[model samples]
Target: MTLFRGPVQAAPAEPCNTFAVPTVIAPIEGPERVVWEPDGPLVPWQVAGADDLWVEIDHTRDLLRRFEAEGPQPDRIIDRIENAGHLVVVSGPRQSGKTTLLHKAVHSLALRLDDRMRTWSNVEQLVPAQERWTARSPQELSHVRVVALAGPRNAPAHVAWAAGRPLDVDQVHDRILRKVRETLGKPEVEDGHPPGSEDLYVAYERLSRQLIEDRTVLLILLPDFGWGGEGLTGRFYRSCRDNARCGIVFFVESRNDTGCADDLRTAFGDELGTENVTHLALGPMAEGDWRDFIDARHRAAIPGAAIRVAAEVTDGAPALLTGASVGKLRKVLYAATQHAHENRRDEVDAATLRAVGRAFEVPGPDQFRRDGASRQQTEEPRP
Candidate 1:
């Protein structure tokens, strides 16, 4: 008999079926206000404004932590942020774990926030800021700022903290909103702006300029940015993307094939201008990604060879990998590993992979692999 180690987590029982894509939520007509502890059951999509946005961000952060994901491995975006000089555009298909990746990246950035006087809050615990922070100099800490935008589809968030300090999510988000409102000459005290006036890109550019002046660093994470069309925020972001000196690193997630009208391609044009804006198309996991995904967590310590075969059969689709009902890949792998162990093997073998794949009704390696980039620059706009 074998025992599991410290980090080996059980696969989640539920499927990754809830869509984060906020539908065509028409911009609210009047000045949007932030109301905390609202009455009645409210659909997240219907509410809009700063507090609501705050609510959305808070909800988004929580929803992710609620799941038991196999630990994510370090990727190009994480590497680039640490090294600097890159704004990443993360695009992927519907239900492809793009939001999850964004959350992981923010968590990484939070680890870099660098404040000993503050505490980092996770879903279930309070972490010391010093343990999570990573900055060698006060100057480094001052310049590097990270903010996550829940965007138009969700409510704008208004997390407040003490003055001139950013050691917590509330502080970082509040500071971000305040600075933008200040730059726009709006009252800094207001939690939200008038509808269509909460132009995030405008706020982003303003913060970028201030950082540039102080030689500081900024990382802005905008997950599910469902705003496009000739909106105020849209053009603001476009103009900033054209500039070479915008000194901010952006991690944005959008529909893999967002409309041309959205101008993401235009903003991140041609190898990201100076690689200042790095556009990465995320699709199915590569065979190796699958291997790493499974291997990262202590999921029965299945042999690498067997895991690779399992990954191949799924064709790297995150939906299939995560969805409890999609391919049952997690359960299949677990059973196969147990079978191999019972056979007195050290690793999963080809026979086990086949037997499991067949029994679990999962596809084989011959299934068509849909790379995310296949639709790049070719997906026609929806009518």
Candidate 2:
């Protein structure tokens, strides 16, 4: 008799990660539009709903354990984090779905951080590949926190512009401390702060640094963060740079803005440099993507009907496509399909598409520009 441990078969080659790579983002004639070149082999069904942007979003929401979201960008965002390491700075234009992207990534990282393996099946699937089988291992939990969700409508105009006020280091300290306690399930160590030390910021920096040195978690998500105000809140970010302890993700409209940029330079410093920073540029999807998306949604191809109308009206912007009432979209889809079926047409034409757009109240170019100009005029300062 012989005992031989043969190599277990390799897990099926994970589908080539074509979706994670970057592609050409071509500028459109107007509408601040940029196109995503559909060069990747990835298809809509692989990520989520085939053509229904709404369906893809709902699928991601369920996966991320999030309830309030219009759509999903987990593919883009997850890749961004993987490439950027722990500290990421994300910027895109307003209404570009930055919030959705961030939340999706956070949800994914939280699952990994809180537990190395979600299920025995996942571990069984992975361990053989790594060949690092262990018995009775201690599962470490990282404290992952979602710090802020400030967006345009709800945010205070001056959140980041506090002029020479004390940095709210105490609040940051307390927040981190609370999460740390939660992580440890109790206070595990002492002797971080000095006796009678009135400097809360100093105490916080010391404590946070210690956690980093000991290897804790590295993720904080802040939407439209106003951490640039001269105070402890800003220092908290810089301290992460100084220590390289955690990942702080900032989702903002653009890097052209001064407050967030100024804070990045101040906290991360020239020493940390761009080496530690990742700027993820998000834009509109390609026409081909929408074609695939639509085909997937209907699960059948209509010869003449494509997404030209929807793409033109929404610029293929996920924010515009998503975040709408599903009932409205369902109605649009039903009408288009019903019309095509009734007419015995092979495809959905521009007229049917336009009807869908009209039903959704998606403005045309001239109308959108007129509304924009009117708003700009109204916002103009009076002399």
Candidate 3:
């Protein structure tokens, strides 16, 4: 089957003059020197440099190191998972490091299980249509597994598609179980597991058995599980709870409203309690992290071109922060520094930050206010 690939657009070439703010004086004592250059064919100054901002990109390695060094929190997730139960639900605000935390967990697990365990992301690639068919041969199935099902928040098309499906609750459950069985290469049921025989749970047990027999582990990554109805949520939570041998079910979600977490708690009740789940929240990176990032970038620089670029972008969202290029960031940094040099200020101040942010069209207080209002209006239910 042909899959749709989204169209690619060339990055804008012209520096965004509107977004460029007046450069501020160097915050630290340093010789007056040019920090950036504009020679590349690619847009030279698009993103902010590390030193020019209050926040930096969320680096998984740094986070893991910090967590390990500082010791776990009172409500630490890794500790909770190790001591308590198998199911974990990680929720956080949009652009929070929920997905990154999930990936980190998978990485840690991979160290112990190695090739025996496999990690799959819900958003990685579309499941092949042929997965709907029953596997007729043993070669088709896998062993122990971990699966993550992620969907984007507010995916109306996804919601509509699921709602339009004709399958009842039981049918939906059965189909999911069958798919699991096929993926694991287990013997197909001549007469399927009982109508409500906890088939979802049973399928997990079968997967575990395959893993133990093959001496391998399976890790499934399910992200975006928050984008469905309560019933679907309930079933998923229930399946995780009842299946004793299932490796782990990691539920990744944006921390929008506490409603999503509350719903999961209400739906699963005793079977899938909060105590059994792990909650990981990804927040903004600190200035220190940004400093380290800058140091690294500086090391990578071509001698004299090492300049600090710091501009607020997308509310310091990790995706957006990391999505931009070094050159773009360098341009903003250079522009800001030049402005500061011209102004003869001792240090870069908040005004310079704001100017740089505005010049880049990074959403400011005004844009944020407008966006917040729009979000409220859209979420409000009609009478």
Candidate 4:
């Protein structure tokens, strides 16, 4: 029943971690701030889509649960990821909850990693072969390493091989190695350091395999990988896919082409084989779907701020809510909740929503102003 067998290193003199360990991985050229840091628990509607107060919609809950439950289960989907890595394609229109869902999934996976690391710590000689794993603090969640596979718009500054020239596999390999080192808090060395093989791909393959040898999952986030008849992009995808032992999740905007997922599947299926790729698409939210989300926020997160929707508020009640997109809906509701709190209103009725709409300059129907609700719902704050 020995799950892990590695060389044991002496424990540190003190329990506290002395050196900087990579507890998080941010895109080298993405958002200026870290991805998973939450300041405090605020009203669910007050935060942006990517914020910690994300509402679990019907489509995303199941996938998120799977990530949370990711462990050493041999029969699960994660086992497939461990074998040859896996690709998850998430497609949605603009403002359709893509970023929110992906962020939630990554957060869930990190939590699972934290739990597994706790269990691993209880066993002797079960630590990773790498010395960096021995240097982490108990408070740090370092089991899961996240990195962006491709930057947004595939910018040249972020991706080294993304210039107008032909695809250089060595350049791609070197870029990935640098990011991985940066994630592990290791000092970056010059090209071909400790030169194993002249082939850079071989070097990258060995490092990736060793990094995940302790059952750690390297989660690669790729945003908006537009398919353009399999030119340099396809080569880049193939090069990365073939070399690394990492799980990749592609977030694509499907407003332009609804078949973006199918395109990716057909393109990578031959290389990855069948059942290794799963695609999830987020579309418009139904009335019941969004209503449940809002109600759940009220019941669980924001019980004090009761915002009852009027009966007249049908699927298209808030005319300013453009496209029923979750992102847009969240923004509008956040503004409404802010206004309600500022104005000292107990309930966010149609009138409050109308005021929010006017302030945001979101044109609404004339009838919406007349359909204000007279009743109110309230909840006392917990002592």
Best by lDDT: 4
Compare candidates 2 and 3 on lDDT and give the better one. Answer: 3
Please give, for residues 95-196, the per-residue lDDT of candidate 1 as tens digits: 334444454444444334323112221112222222001111222234345544554221223322234222232233345566544543445324333333
Every model's Cα RMSD, please?
15.6, 14.8, 15.2, 12.9
- Where is model 3 more than 4 Å wrong at Cα? 1-85, 115-197, 226-231, 244-251, 254-257, 268-275, 284-383
Model 4, 1-383: lDDT tens digits are 11333653433232211111112333588532212221211111112222324556676676556544442221232243564554555555555566556555555555454455445545323433322212232223445566655432221133432545432546655665677667656553234444333465456545555554555556665554333443444444445444444423322222222445546555586554344444556655654566665655444322123444444443454566543455556556666666666787655667777887766544322211212221011111111
Regions of model 2 farther than 4 Å from truth = 1-86, 103-173, 176-184, 187-216, 226-240, 243-263, 266-269, 284-289, 292-356, 359-383
lDDT of 2 by residue, 1-383 (tens): 11114462322232211112112222566322112222221112112111223324432334334322312222222232342223445443333334445444554454454343223113322222111111111222223333442321223233333353332544434444455455445475332343232544344344445444443444544434344333444465554333332223333323222244556666666654444444343433323343344535443222223322234433444432343223333345455545555665445565555544555654222321213342332121211
Which candidate has the top score in TM-score? 4
What residue runs in model 4 are displaced by over 4 Å at the alpha carbon? 1-52, 62-83, 113-140, 148-173, 187-200, 212-215, 225-233, 246-259, 269-275, 302-316, 321-323, 358-383
lDDT agreement with native, every candidate: 0.37, 0.36, 0.39, 0.45
Q: Residues 311-355, candidate 3, lDDT per residue (tens digit)?
A: 332225332224323334445545565565567543334456456
Clashing pairs in 4: none
TM-score of each: 0.39, 0.41, 0.47, 0.59
lDDT of 3: 0.39
